[model samples]
Target: MRVTLYLRCRGIAPGTVDLVSTGLKTDHRGILVFTLPDNHPETLRLGTNDLTALNPEGRVPILLLPDGRKMTQSGPIIDLIESTLAPDDDITLLPTDPWIRAEVQRIMWIIAADTQPYQNIPFIIQAMGEWGMVKDNPTRHPLRLHFIRREFGAIENLLTRCAGKFAVGDSVTLADCFLVPQIRNALLAEIDLPSEFPILSTVWNNLLDVPAIRAVLDDAGGIVQPLVYDAEQFEVYNG
Candidate 1:
């Protein structure tokens, strides 16, 4: 099946959701990726684009299915990918056991719902403006750090009970897809993961070694690029 993903170009500060989508593509393969302009999301927010037509929320990581349907929001998009996987597929983003599945979802949500949204660029830009602070204000670092550290701390504590080589187990799951990117964000914020959250640090290190995860990082030059598509120029990977 052909799938098209719309996302932003991978740069110094990559989008969190974009990484999740890219990680999935690395595992699932046969996905066509289109890199969007960096300003694409800002255009939607500034009333300059019709991105809302595809996604009411105006977010990236929009997945266009082969059947001409579109899926938005990373969590639901991940769900769609998991649902469509054949039983014999080599990679299982979501585990089969009920308890393990819940554990996986738990980590995914902590990053997706609790961590990423709060520290996202758009939100941080607006927040700094509201406080009448300059873009490079020293205080801004703490704001981003607070959210990352808080969430990482909680996940660290949980990891003691659930983690193995990865977030929840030895194999990569949806949680790791959601996690590695967040760890990148933390590093961008200057938070020392190994120093603060040892368990997460170990998992982050292990995740980097996985081929799917490593390829995603290497392809983006240590981050992830967005998906913007042109019918003629799209690249297809059938992993």
Candidate 2:
């Protein structure tokens, strides 16, 4: 059975991938696509709210797992992060230089896990701040976005060193996947996109062409269009 994950990015902020692009089941039975909210309650899942109660065993076809305790999409992305970068002992793949591969993995780490906090938390706060939707003392709305930007700002500088075609290393890696969506939001959050973030923005631009990511954005119909870049033109990378 093909399973679809519904993600709500309406309130997503700048510089981070949040309820937008984090779904990762990778099941072959069905293709993943975003559905409209008006079409909601009709899809497999109502919203992309990260309900781990769907699958407990951490199995494939994550949305329809009928047994065990459910694990959220978090587990799948984490496992992918580790496996995709880990060195392979099976010599069948590449007999190339180990040092180069190791360096590749190192850069992937910088883009994927290292850059996450900056993209997500800050983006959310910034979005909330923009609409003045943030609440008072019960929540530290005063400091959320400011604190997050400090982190993303650091990442923009780090990109100056490791960037080329992507945020880290010459080739695209997990970092690119982790980054593109966040960049979309960052732009939306109106985060200053000056030359200081050239490298980071470059990586975000490159990711606009990935078929999987593109498919998700393209399939998302109506209202959600404003949430993604070039939803007006179906383009993720403006450059």
| lDDT digits (tens) for residues 105-202 of candidate 1 | 99989988998888765455445445553454222346667788889999999999999998898877778878877777777666777889999999
Candidate number achieving the greatest lDDT relative to the actual structure: 1
Off by over 4 Å in 1: 1-49, 131-140, 223-239
Per-model C-alpha lDDT, please?
0.62, 0.41
Q: What is the overall TM-score of model 2 with all chains considered together?
A: 0.46
Kindly provide the TM-score of model 1 when superposed on the true structure, using C-alpha atoms: 0.70
Compute the lDDT of residue 212 as modeled in candidate 2: 46
Clashes per candidate (backbone, < 3 Å): 9, 10
Q: Flag regions of model 2 displaced more than 4 Å.
A: 1-52, 55-69, 73-75, 78-144, 220-239
Predicted candidate 2 versus true structure: per-residue lDDT over 23-135, tens digit per residue = 43211212222232233332335454332333443223343223333334542543432343445443111214575445444544544455444444323333543555454
| Model 1 poorest ten-residue lDDT run | 1-10
